[model samples]
Target: MKITLIIPTYNAGSLWPNVLDAIKQQTIYPDKLIVIDSGSKDETVPLASDLKNISIFNIDSKDFNHGGTRNLAVAKTLDADVIIFLTQDAILADSDAIKNLVYYFSDPLIAAVCGRQLPHKDAN
Candidate 1:
């Protein structure tokens, strides 16, 4: 199945670089990576812009609605069979992360699958 990844970001700073690194380690690469950035004053846009398979769109920070922005990203990826959402701070524990998550969709009834979220090492 063709899958697309959508990540919503603001001034994500150094967190997003680690997230992208983890993505690169995934056994299965997403067919497309759509980054919806909300007017970050930092380097967030430039950092994700050059990545392979990445498509970026910008919106005013005030215009960024978690639900609405995600809906817009979904609309842009009509070609994908499944959509995966991730936060900029999320990092995969292993290369099998995406592979394992996508496996659940083998059942036609399963419309979506969410990966496990472990607390960050620095999280209190």
Candidate 2:
């Protein structure tokens, strides 16, 4: 099954690296990694360009709203079977996280599933 992971970012330099690294570490990488930036005034775009296997989109609007940016990103990937939305600050642990999420979709009745976020030991 094809899955698209959408990560909406805005001046997310402080956390974007961790999120990208986490995605790279995933055992079951997303078919497509969409990084939607809302005119970030940092090196976020450059950093995203350095990553392999990622699709980056820059929203050039002067006005920025989180939901609007996400909606735009979602519109860009309407063909995907599943859309996994993650924030720029989110760090995915366990390489199999994506795999696990996809596994749950095996049940026809399950529309969506979300996992809990626990503080990383290093974050303490």
Best by lDDT: 1
Per-candidate TM vs. native?
0.95, 0.86
Q: Which stretches of candidate 1 lie over 4 Å from their true place?
A: none
**Residue 58 error, candidate 2, Å:** 1.6
The TM-score, computed over Cα atoms with residue i paired to residue i, of candidate 2 is 0.86
List, residue by residue over 8-123, the lDDT tens digit for candidate 2. Answer: 77888676788778888888777887888878899787887766667898877575577888888889888888889987777887788888888889899999989767765556
Most accurate candidate by TM-score: 1
Candidate 2 C-alpha RMSD relative to the actual structure: 2.2
How well does candidate 1 match the true structure, expressed as C-alpha RMSD?
A: 1.1
Q: Compared to the true structure, candidate 1 yields what TM-score?
A: 0.95
User: lDDT tens string, model 1, 77-123?
Assistant: 99998788998888888999888988999999998777889988786
Which pairs of residues have clashing backbones in candidate 2?
27-95
The collision pairs in model 1 are none
